[model samples]
Target: MRARFIFSALATTLIGTAPALAQDDLSVDQVLGAWQKQKQIFHEAQSSGLGQTRGLKLIAVEGVDAAETAPQQGVSVTASTDAPTSTDTTPMDPNKPLVAATATTTTTTAPLVFGQLDPELQVNLQIKFGFDSAALADDQKPRLDKICQAMKLSDVQLFRIVGHTDTAGTDTYNERLSVLRAKEVARYLVEDCNITASRLETLGLGERFPLNQDDPRADENRRVEFQALS
Candidate 1:
């Protein structure tokens, strides 16, 4: 009887903890593979030359190895008129010639600018969990307020809010929660801080970006980042 009771307790423990262990066992290689795939898709879309129809062109689609020849190289034009019975062949008074001539040429090069993320506006805002109206603790409010004030002072034309979550729950639930948290923060910024509705965009990354992968359930990994478009 004693052996049976011990065996039953061991089985219960393993069954209860299996899901929790699985949740925290994501591999770094898997994360990196996903990131590389996303990068490849982005580059392929950029190099496909379809952006020109939308007024966005890749400045360096033709790589540096592809040389361009000058459009006007070796190009020439000439004009002549029949001489008047060999009488008008007397140099035409140097500058009083009866024929006028002109030539025009043009060349173009791609602009030097390239597509890149802005450097100054990639700030991270922490939306720490709390039960009251405030998302963060009272001690952290001053720091958050400073960030809000700085954003207000800048010529920020657009805002992007991206949310992330620790790898705790199912992917679907985490994704939904992340989006909701991002929207909640955006609403606070728009209503309480006077940020305009048209200037806001929201995204949720779920558990895809863990600050500490060894501990996927760490609260610090759950965050929302803010980006400003000038």
Candidate 2:
């Protein structure tokens, strides 16, 4: 009880110091704990025909918050320093053919609409921009800087920054805006936060995945998410 109390106090302090993102219950240490994603990539050997066209066979990828829903293949994480360790859960089946496997390395179980997205690690801040434009306000930069600190502190080296928007404009316009917004946040991380360009990736959802399904045009939907990648 004493240790838990001290940790909670520290968390409160950290949240208090964070930029506008204080609205969301995110802390730098929590980010570190819940960031690393694990995946079991299977590399199939080449055959006589074009069966091995797809070089890398992605067997299973566990997202940040997939511990409960996802299979036991993921590295389970908690909002504490004592992070859970992951081991090779999937044992090879004897029936499968022997292949020289060079072990080379999703909100939805299906996969993020266009590619990959994780809403669990996303900071639900409205990252306010100039009306209808992608121009970010000066005040919001610090909040993003806090995010940069969290990303740098995380165990995963690669990070994905996906942009989202409120469903208030046309589909095309929203899409473009989302892209620009995502790029802007990425730019801040790279330029201001000193994060490497190659380590980060950007994507735009454009109001497709609403945080508040009841109100698609809610301010919470207009946010930027940073997800850790393995």
Candidate 3:
């Protein structure tokens, strides 16, 4: 009952925004074979003269050059600087990603940026959260249990749990809700499923990549997706 109310309340509310990343992104031990093959499509689109023809933009938070937009109109700044730590206390730009002119990969080479990650990479889980709520819905334990069991296998190494939402609220509201839900789900896996925290990474893309773009209000669009990311 509470979940239903919370879900309905979401339509009128707005959530705050945070940095693009929730925490330090640790390097993956090994990239999954399937993911690598899927990633190849992105690389081809990048190298081809036609450019990232899929309308995808290169976005980075902080793995290489930390570029930020200035408050002044049309003013932007780019520089080679170290990624800031959580403990660093200083007035800085808000946690919006710096856009790059062209498509480029991150970390060991260029800055960490978004790639044309296939939507199929996102696993459809019945994970749902209410507005301004981080608590995982009580339903769908059997489905979640099967996912947890898969992660426990030896062959599977590291994975990412991503949160998404339907087009019901402000982008900021949905983004934060997604993050909170993803973090909470990660917490459950670590504490309840006995999975190592280091092996699981979490992120929230909000409503950017909905499963049912045609019907934005679809419940399946509001979900947590698990992908074997390296």
**Native-to-model Cα distance after best TM-score fit, residue 81 in candidate 1, in Å:** 92
As for TM-score, the candidate ahead, 1 or 3, is 3
Residue 163 displacement (Å), model 3: 0.6
Cα lDDT of model 1 by residue, 33-151, tens digit: 32233333334434553233121122232211111111111111111254323122222222221221111323334321222121121244556654212133345444345445645
Task: Return the TM-score for each candidate structure.
Answer: 0.44, 0.56, 0.53
List where candidate 1 sits over 4 angstroms from the true fold: 1-122, 130-143
Q: Candidate 2 overall Cα lDDT vs. reference?
A: 0.47
Q: Please give the range of 10 consecutive residues that has the lowest summed lDDT in model 2.
A: 1-10
Off by over 4 Å in 2: 1-23, 37-123
Index of the highest-TM-score prediction = 2
Q: What are the per-residue Cα lDDT tens digits for candidate 2 across 1-230?
A: 00000000111110111122322476777656545321111111112111221222112212212212121122211112232234322332323221111111223333221222233433445688776655556788877655778767765655656678989999767865676567666656776787776566555668766677677797877888665544
**Superposition error at 124 for model 3 (Å):** 1.7
Of 1 and 2, which scores higher on TM-score? 2
lDDT of 3 by residue, 1-230 (tens): 00000011111112222212111121122223333443344445445632443422334423222121101111111111444232332222323322111112132333334332444333456554444556544574444675666567534445656677988998877765676466667767776788876566556667866667678778777777665533
